[model samples]
Target: MTRLFNDPTAFADELIDGFVAAHPGHVRPVRGGVVRATRCTSDTVALVIGGGSGHYPAFGGLVGPGIAHGAAMGNLFASPSTQQIVSVARAASNGGGILLSYGNYAGDVLNFDAAEAQLNAEGIPTRTVRVTDDIASAPASEKHRRRGIAGDLTVFKVAGAAAEAGYVLDEVVRVAELANERTRSFGVAFTGCTLPGASEPLFTVPEGRMALGLGIHGEPGIGETDIPSADGLAQLFVEELLAELPEGVASPKGRRVALVLNGLGSVKYEELYVVYGCIARRLQEAGVTIVEPEVGEFCTSFDMAGVSLTLFWLDTELELFWRAGADTPGFRKGLVSPRPRVSAESGVQKKPSSEAVMVPASEESRAAAPRIVAAVDAIAAVIDAHVEELGRIDAVAGDGDHGIGMQRGATAARAAAHAAVEAGAGAGSVLLRAADAWSDRAGGTSGALWGVMLRALGTRIGDEDAPDAHAIAEGAADALAGIRSYGKAEVGDKTMVDAIVPFVETLVARVIDGEQLGDAWDAAAAAATAAAAATADLLPRVGRARPHAEKSLGTPDAGAHSFGLIATAVAATLTRKDFAR
Candidate 1:
């Protein structure tokens, strides 16, 4: 959702206009959406950069002191036209020389190369440097086939430094080529990006899986994998990228590397740390000292959910250029980092929800109508306390928003109960309406399953037939059959079935003596506890969660626990008279 611009078609112009507007003293706009630094140094070689839109600062924002002399901006993710690039080349060229530079991709090659040839024809001598750093793109024998990712920033900096140091255009281009030779990148995608005005993803990836080796332009990846933890995913990328590096590849004569922890688009800085932590450890383990690690959104694809790891093998020369002072809107040499004085002992801690399985218990004829309201309130309170925990569990195995789902459901249920109370609705009617509200607000697998059980209870208690013990038993049986049929869940499947089976089995047995509802509820709760405990033995059979399904064996299913608690709380407060409504 990079919507700071007004028009999708006019994105290039709008973006360049904004850049010039923000730094009036630093840059001047050229036609075809290019911007050049206003300051002049005709004696020095000039650096010219160009790229498509959405990769900010690579071309435009980087046009400032110690960076690019000019930038050519293109339509959203579309390569700049030959004319657009040549326009910038003419403006950025100093009297001494001009060096053309850009990331390597098919469209970029066509546009920038055409511009370079056109510039030479016009008698303005120029040299071009192409950046291609993504190692996953091809084997070493075909390294030229790799795509340029975040590594372009480093390549541009080296080229710019050469130009700024009064080197000829040839020398600047030569240094840019050397930087490209040593750089490599790898990336993983948790989600895909949508092009502006397009409804579907630019690339396709199945839900709940990360696409490995994907490029910035929504290109296909080697494959998809499930990542349940940050550490696990980092290992996969680092180990695979380093395995086939050519001898003499990677920092100072291959002794060290600089890292760019780049967020492609929508990934947050908070989540980036999880990946960076693992990457730093792997680099240290491989005996590669990291000179300077930069973490931020330098390269992006219009809110795509991914990140790329780029390594620069530094020599004394390139290391000096890296350490040289430079500032761009996106690329900064040094930003404020708070001192790492650890006063903080930190502990750090997905999905549509599933349904709850509920069974009715037979109760003796008794009077206890006044306490039902208190019981419903208690049930809502229990749901509130576990909302955050439930969401965390779902995120691990599912879409990672179950906490939000549960909170919404609990809030709606409580509101419904209060609304009914204001209108003088009775205890049974309040529970009925509250359950309906929950079903309407919470629309996942969990919602429907729980809804069916609550509806069955309200109907059974509200019926005029005065259901006998056997009638209530039959109702409980119906609820069980519906959940099994609808959710297609099986016992020991790591689903609500774990808690549900025991609760129903116990209630069915207790009905024979026409037990009081409160007493029957207590029995069912005990059974639920035991059943949930038993699940510690089974591995997960579903939910697309990786490796942890084995370790999750000891933890109760969050969905099942929620189901049991709600049912037990309801049954414990109602008597035979309470069922009369």
Candidate 2:
């Protein structure tokens, strides 16, 4: 449990501030995250790695020479916004291209890929190599679908080393991909981790039992078993990994591998050593040759009592990179030469935000701004009332941050909408402000999707004219299209798309049939509600929940459920006489 904190909402930001203050020599704070303080060559490829903020050494600590050049940190258990990634990449780039890497989670992939595309458009070459190394997350036949765990280190290390070796951008990306393919990890937890201000752990293991295949984000394990001895656990890890060696590797006998016995937060150094001692003996007995075996916290959950084993099978080239020296805030290897330190320029200028465009509007549309503000407030209130229940549902198969993320996004959007209305903004302008606020504060898949929806809807509702029933329907259509374009989730993927698609289709049909705005919205809300409930029968095929698809059965997706709830609540608000005015 997390005991020390100011406001829970400000934890991540404050932690970053203090971390940078404490380690100025190793890291310097940038707009998005921390970057290496040590200067790099003018034409060296920058390795920018990241995910959520809870994973400490994994991201920020790994920023230095021979490691990640920068890390785009997000809120706890959430992927960084595309803007954040872009900011970090811009801060780290030095003429050479940028190579982005992270665990292969849906949010990470979507955000990073968007950032990569944006950088390329800006004439800065960029590439991405997602790490999918958790053997327990997917079968050998579908290894590409696996979620990365502790093995994130293997890919990050190899990629950074390749970049340090002055390999071109393409070769650096190739080495990172190869490292990802060779690495495999499995994790187990004796206890669950609790986020700040949360009353309970996201999930728990029963007394005398252990959870298997647990995620680093407080997500519950896929299976449970009786607790095993240190030696038993080590043997289990070795056997499980060796059972499915990478293609062309018949056996581990005489093959050199880099081994990482990582402690997932609460587990102490002594415990890791105990486990690693057994692991070492077992590997030697199995005819496996281990090189550069590391035992400590390389990645972590906030305070999970767990451990993970990563096997990075090494070829000759990989072996040389694996043995290379690294100097970083969290990790140090071999001898490193002292280098001159640097920092982000204090006078650096920021670019205009996407919403900086000045939109023209009519008095009629401007008059409708108050209604949009009211709708935003209504949505936020409903989300506030259901935060806990939504979190509970999400915990079944995903990191249980959906509720908090929504709450933060809704709060931010409400504030932004109110400010826009007070400033005499039109409906479209209010919606656009709210959209940016939601995405910026929320920082997750939900945040990103909600932002896209709001922005698309705002664009269609153009400030120049009052939005009629047809205009509203078109806005909904645009929102749905934006979601599909970025999220890539179809109707049956068990995401908010399931509810939103039906809502848009139904509303569009009703409006075309001559129904009024309020009536059409009520009908659409009902359709969304029904579709959301139907998600209980679906198995997730995307996002963080996909790996635990079976566990999500019989429960509606939290995002879909929330969409239905918000749509219904907004319908009631829209039916008010004040809104009709």
Candidate 3:
């Protein structure tokens, strides 16, 4: 992996030099790799933010009129030395003392503190504000000691706004402290992030598993678990934050939340927003009103595949500064909020209620209740039986969550079946029931994909006749087509398609070959078994597990494994009578 750099050692310095060259009126580079952005005056208190590099628009790009006065930029993922922080402190501070801010990291505290004392000796009163918003880092006993994740932007913005509004150094630091106190963040990593010029990642996150509570530096999060959808993951993250919310943040007045959807490194803002939509819905359900939301890559790691959500409890005054107009290169003034602008608008605005959307299940779904229930029960049993086997394979190539995912899906499917049966619903209705239940229980693409397949199959079953080669083959074809339509994956993607494609194809071929339904199913099962084996030679073509393509070269996909298990269950449905003389 090539990087955009002249050299790793002087990457920060060279970038700062070029930046000053490009914007001479805006900034000037100093010793120890600090960039003092212009407007260095003796009248106003200065804002100094610093940290390791790679998280751009931070500690550097954020330097401007309403942002930081100057930034003590560090090397890539490396905190600046004490001397560097001290030098930037002096350069940025004119007559007014400085308020220093950085993420919650040991090296940053040490270096910045040393700089603070040094500036104090020079008659420049200095204060340090540490951003510690990651709620996943510690419990209440250690909340003050948790690592800062993405909420640093809110801290920077609040602190900078205070300073720009002519607040004294002490007041500016107070704002920073308040921002940190109000904020909480948590995240899960899909994969570890690799640093610039490094061949390997800073850490390894097992495939198909999300490391909940993962730190910015690729640290272990809550023990690895099955990767859920963007919606489910957001729910988990928000619930964790809600569980750990500090006392004294009430609603409608003193209770306002400032949300920050921060990209850890490589995850895009669009994906982050999909997760944010989940969180927003849940928070509203909980009666926590959003004061303001800043959604974008405010703070980031180095191409780490993860996202962090930060919620800051706000007071009336703090909320004002948060909404205050400011223009930084990356963070600009936000849109006019729907709330009363307090700037004296003419008329009271009417808020529109949402229109309800309704979709009814297909009639086919209403007719196939018994078959759907039986299928779900048998499939659940298969998962229960092969749990250890699936885990063993996953342990070799992933974080070992495949068994958990499958079992969870089966459990959900069974629950949906039971509910449908109790309600006297048909198969199609039961499948529609399974869709939401399965998504709630299972976490990844396969989980939703399979649930959709079941739902679609249920709808088709209304037209399905009693077991016969032609009817069975057609129904099987419908199920497979529905799966393909929902998942949008081609055959040979090394997914469940390995078993699914051949299983359906073989059944169709057998029916055309004049076989009975039982004989066709047998043939289909055998073909699926072959496809599962053939998966050993295929490459991954989709999902989070795709990157590790070559790694599972000789292993059967868990999807294929799950399909084979289902086929076995279907085959077992056939029985032989006690043989007589």
Candidate 4:
């Protein structure tokens, strides 16, 4: 459990600040995350790697000479926003192209892909390689769907080494993909982790039981069994990894591999060494050779009593890169030549926020802005009230951070909306500013989708006039379109899309039938509520919950449920006589 923190919501930011302060010579703080304090060669490809913040050393700690050039740190258990990723990439670029890499979670993929496209459009060459190395998340045939775990270290190490060797962006991406394809990891946990300010752990293992194939984001394991001995656990890891060797490797015999025994927080160095001793003997008995075996915390979930073993099958080229010199705060290998420090004045500049500008609008549009602010405030209040329940539901299958993410987003949105209204902005501008704030603060799949929804609706409801019932309905429809296009989740996927689809359909139909905005919204909110409840019976076909689909059989998706709650709250706000359309 995380015992020390000023505020749970600000933990990630605060930790990053401390990390930079501690490693002043190695890294400097950027707008989105941390970058190498030392300058790199102009022709070297920039390797930007990141994900949710709980996995330390993994992201921010890996920024240095032979590893990551920059890291786009997100909030705890949440992917960084697209804007955040772009900021890090822009700061890291040194004439050479950028290579974005991270775990293959849905949110990371969505945000990183968007950042890649945006960078390319802006004439900055960029590409991405999502690390999908967790063997337990998906079957061998569907390895592409697997989520990244402790194996993230191997991919990042290889890519960073290649970039340090002055490889081009295309070559760096190629090696990183190869590294990902060659790596496989399996994990087990004896206990669950608790988030800051949370009363309970995300999930718990029964007294003497252990969870098998657990995730790094505090997600519960897919299977459970009685706790095994140190030797037994090592044998299990070796057997599981050897059973599914990468495409090229026919068998473990006569092959060399880089082994990483990763401690997923709370597991001491002595415990890891004990497990590694048995693992070493087992691999040697199997006629396999191990190189550069690492036994410590490489990536972690905060205070989770678990361990993961990663097998990186090495070829000649991979072996060379694996043994290469690198220097970073968390990881150090061989010797790296010291480079000159980056000048403070030459560091990356913070990008201007969208909310800083106030667009002109008609009196009617400005008059409606207060109602938007009120609705956002109501949303924050409702989310605050149900944060625990939402976290509990999400813990059934997901990482159990949906409630925290929604709280951050809603609170930020409410503040932004109020500021926009005070600035005499129109309803559209208020929504737009709030959307940016939500996405920037929340930093996850839900945050990204909500930003898309609000941005689309706000764009449709320009600042020229007050929005009518038909116009509002049209805006909702546009929001639906944007969410579907951006997230690629359909109605039955057991995501927020399920509730959003019904709400938009009901709202559009009611408005078409000459209903007032308030009445139409009430109907839409009710429809969303029913649809959200219905999602409990559907299996998740996408996102992190898909792997543990059966566990969530009787629980509604956190995203859908939270959307329903927000819609209901907004409906109540719209029905108020003081809220003029």
Highest TM-score scorer: 4
Report the Cα lDDT for residue 84, model 2: 81
Each candidate: what lDDT?
0.65, 0.88, 0.68, 0.92
Q: Lowest-lDDT window of 10 residues in candidate 1? A: 342-351
Residue range with the least summed lDDT across 10 consecutive positions in model 3: 339-348
Task: Report the Cα lDDT for residue 194, model 3.
Answer: 52
lDDT tens string, model 2, 1-581?
88888877778889888888888888888766888887888998999999988887878989888889999888888888887889889988977899999998888888898899999999999999999999888888988888888899989998998899999999999999999989999999999888887888888899999999989888778899999999999988998888889875788898889999999989999988999999999989888899999999999998889999999999998988888889988888887778887745641233343446446668998898888988899999999999888888888889888888888889999999998877777898889999988987788899899999999988888788776777778889999989999999999999999999999999999888877778889999999999999999999999888878998999999999999999999998776243221
Q: Flag the better candidate by lDDT, 2 or 3.
A: 2
Q: Which tens-of-lDDT digit does each residue in 452-546 have in candidate 4?
A: 98888888887998877778899999999998999999989999999999999999998888788898899999999999999999999999999
How many Å off is the CA of 16 in candidate 1?
Answer: 2.1
For residues 210-319, what per-residue lDDT tens digits would candidate 1 score against the true structure? 88877665554556788548888678767765775544663323367778888988889988888888988887888778888888888787778898888888888888
What root-mean-square deviation over C-alphas does model 2 reach?
2.1
Which parts of model 4 have CA positions greater than 4 angstroms off? 349-356, 576-581
Report how far off residue 549 is in candidate 3 (Å). Answer: 31
Count of clashing residue pairs in every prediction: 13, 0, 6, 0
Higher-TM-score candidate of 2 and 3: 2
Give all TM-scores, in the order shown.
0.56, 0.96, 0.56, 0.98
Whose lDDT is higher: candidate 3's or candidate 4's? Answer: 4
Residue 215 displacement (Å), model 3: 2.0
